[model samples]
Target chain A: MENRNQITAKQLGVFVLSAQVGLGVVGLPSDLVKEVGHDGWISILSAGILSTVITVIVIALLRRYSNQSIFEINRHLYGKIPGQIINFLLILYLGFLMVIGFRYFTEFIKLFTLKATPELFLALLIIAPTAYLSWYGLKPVARFSGIIFVILFFFLLLNLLTLKKIRVSFLMPVGAADLAALGQSIIPALLAFVGLELTVFLYPYITDKRNVLKWVIIANLCTSAFITIIFLVTMGYFGENLLKMQVAPLFNLARYYRAPYFGRVDLFFILLWFPLLESTFRSYFFTTYDCMRRYFSFKDQKLAYGLYAALTILLSRLPKDFTQATQLGKVVNLAGIAVFGFLSLCYLYSFFNKRGVKAPCGKS
Target chain B: MSTGMVSCVTIVVSTVTLIASLSLPPWGLGLPARILKFTALFFAALFGILGLIVTASVTFAHLVTLESLGQPYFQPLIPFKPGKYDRKKRP
Candidate 1:
């Protein structure tokens, strides 16, 4: 019988896409517009290219030890004590990512749909489903992500309705953004692509070892293309000045159009988008849960799930308002980048050491 | 009709389901499997309660945005499907 934990290469692609596309879709357009004018698409494209390179590096490193996750690889390369420390740090980082993404999702819901719902309750709504889905492990998460990926495609198609109202001239004088501006935009753009590094943890669970790289790269490209199209549409519809003022441009794009039956498409869109949002949240939640279980060698799985759920709910509510939440996000983004760099250094260390490279027979 | 009643009903239903489901199992479920079932049921209850709370708290403008099976849940009311509800034209 096939291993229950394993997912197909295509599922892997969808998994990464689902993870990368979440909170970024809501706010990325306005942020990019603020930083790069109409050339935000260009900045997103460049960030995509850069993220693809990092993904390739990550895949290359994982390829060396096909059977091991980064956790086990860390243990093997750095020895037990140091490896556990790095693993603990990785767990903390994953937990922080979960907290930040959870807060962002809840905050968006409060701002647009449920204005009166406490953030703590909103966080619980997401956390409950996330904890449930993650308890089964990667296979269920992967399957759910595949379903979300299809929904995401339909969401993207809905954007095309804005074409009638959009002024292509608004994106006129393309490439008007100077090189320095474009350069500055890449940091935020790169931040949008932060979830791609999830490939490191997902590498081993993927069943098709040979094509894992291709799938991950394809996933990143899909995300890049998805975000770029969203930016282009939002920029065309709202222009530079108006786009910068809107917090979540994607929702505005939905609101700009009305279907025959539904009056507020944005509200409908948010309802549809909730599962996609939850799918992304669950991905990070599962990763944190898995990492914690591995690090502590927890025998009681229920306790682990409860602890993680409690920890994320408590920590996610720390930011008082949008400004503070944005600041917290910035810290997480920087920490994500630093974690990626550290992973690369670990890859390099293993490459030169040769003797440290050993493929453990079982899963981490 | 109060929001509190809806929340109470949801919480009670969810709690009952969660408690009852724990006993009706295969009994041979390993620790992980048992946890999986518990997690699913626990969240189901929590979501039911929280979702009802949100449903009660949000305005009708926001509530009508929800749909079931691709059809507007509050159809012919919020959307005011006059054609669908035109009693004057009924033969």
Candidate 2:
């Protein structure tokens, strides 16, 4: 029987794109500028290449056990006790990602749109829809992501309109930064690509296994190209010194544009981008909920959903302010790097152990 | 109140009414079903009254989650199916 929950390779591609290009895109150029000045686009491109390579390794690992998710694959490769420990750690890492995403999103909303709204209430506003969507499972999440992905094109179009104001001289000093600075910038750039690792969790659900890697690589490249364009535009518009001081260069770039009828384009941009932001949050929130459910073996979906929502709400409020939230985001980004390393090590271990290979038996 | 505030209040009230009408069955239902329906209505009202953007966003999210015969209701509208709108052809 065909599984109703299965998503096509195309849906998977857009899902990855939506998840990878969240609130991070807003601040990524600024963060990279701080490290490498005008060479930030180079860092983004390099991170894209590195992430594509990692995607290959991840797909190769998952293809070994094509029927199982990363959670089950962990158990199949390692012993039961160790595998469960690893699964728990994975759950914790996903939870931290969700919390950080939530914190950054709420902080952004508070700063830009709803200043008087309490952080806790803003968190609830996000989690309300997140919980509702996640309750149905990954298929709904993937479908929602595909829809949001279409809306993201408008963002690109808006950014393109700002090209008229950009001074090419601002980007002239490119490659002026030393290789060490460019290398340091790559870590922050890689952080923006963190959601691409979700491929492991999504691999088993994909109906067309043969094209999964191709679509995934395409998604990663698209994200890289998209962010690189934004970075170049931001740098071109603001130059290095001014761009370095911006906390959210993408928004500022949008704010720079003046729509004749709308007056402030930034407000309209925020309204358009709101769904994409929620989509990103939903992607991480769904994955975290899925991992938590599997780890605890929760039978009641409502119970699992309720607990996760409450936990997210409480934990997201831990950051007292925007700076603290940014600090927490940095911590999560480092942890994301660590998780990527751990996944690569698992692949290596599986490669050497002949017993780790399994026949394609379909879903666990 | 200003015109914007009046429009916001009208939107919230209309949303709450629509939610209650849609969620609650006219035929008598069980206590649990009634409570669940009322709770959803309450949330719709709360989100609507809190902020216009939040209410609109939450509604949009909810609308996307609606499925018909196991297929996304808004699939063709979103995710943009150029010619394939036949229900039987989907999936």
Candidate 3:
């Protein structure tokens, strides 16, 4: 058994929750409103429950065996070569997530603050620290990561100032909504909770896996609830006017936001964005590095950062513009499902062959 | 270097847009101009010093404000109206 690192369970929960929720503040409300109209919050709530159940299944699956990393379990249940192959496919999916997160952060800043700044520079600014941080390890990040949430909480409180903007009239009784249309929004909403499954990767590093279930489920629940509040507030302030706007609704909300003394929310978002964005980038960064190392023996941290940087830079360059991003974003979302859902099912199938454990996903 | 790059880009883009707004004249751009004007009023409350310049350059047809443009830091920009001696002229 390789000694990974010790991080307290509380840190794990905070890390996972922040990773999943960071700066989801932007497109979450925009996409949700496009489908469920005013009741978009309901769709987000449902997606959160779905994510909790899926996260619990992943955490439970990882916990069932004693002291083994997910990679070790992959080999345990499914033999050597096949397990390694599945691991390769899964890591590639996480690599794609790195690209999406980086591009979204860069594109967002471009549209709002620096209209003329090239994205590649922004991408480098983020990736350099992310590679350095994840390469450094979790606890160093664990301390400052709490500060990002604090800053995000302060930003979330800004919405409290904007609460007066919410139209009780707009919150009008279920005026009209088609179930099919609202259901269409669920898949993308699920992507907002995407990093919850990192429990499988972090499981090895978690010092006390006992009662891991409580924190895992609670983290997903908090992430979901926070994001739903964000969507409701943002779309409520602007309504369907946001549905047509191409990027970050929160940024637009901030742009128009004014206080009696302090002023626009944009300044706060600019000052604090790097940390929140860093949490998301590091989650994907470490998850991909862990997965890649599982299949291919890479001992050096420098090499890990080098591989991740090259891969993300190449992937970020794939889309030429925003139009292309939409077309590819769907593909990335589907890839997310494969990594989070389908691959978990593969692990479930292998576990099923022995001891006849009750299938947690339920019979299809 | 990164901070400077980000600021330089922001100033450049805002300047270009400011020039475009000047050319369009306040009432000419229709709905968009009015919306842009309304947005500047909010920025004015928040950013303070730059807010008036932003609003004047974009939304208002007249270059008007009682705020000082002759403070040591304010005099460099060519677009500003220098401060007057009358206290009544100050905001």
- Model 2 scores a C-alpha lDDT of 0.79
Give lDDT: candidate 1, residue A14. 77
Give the TM-score of chain A in candidate 1: 0.94
Docking class of 2: acceptable
lDDT of each: 0.76, 0.79, 0.66
**Largest TM-score belongs to which candidate?**
2
RMSD of 1: 12.2
Best-to-worst lDDT order: 2, 1, 3
DockQ of each: 0.04, 0.28, 0.01
What TM-score, to 2 decimal places, does chain A of model 3 have? 0.89
Please give the clash total of every predicted structure, in order. 0, 0, 0
Give a tens-digit lDDT track for model 1, residues A1-364: 1254577777778778888887877888998888888989999999899888888888878877756788888887888999888888888888888888888888888888778767777776656556665666676566666556556777778877667887899898988989999998888888778887777876777778888889888989988988988998888888999999998888887887778866678877776677777777878887777767767777777876787689888888788888898988888878888887888887788877654465556944
Q: TM-score for every candidate vs. truth?
A: 0.78, 0.85, 0.74
* Interface C-alpha RMSD after superposing true interface residues, each candidate, one decimal: 11.9, 3.2, 19.4
Name every residue pair that clashes in candidate 3.
none
In angstroms, the error of model 2 at A207 is 2.2
Residue A107 of model 3 has an lDDT of 73
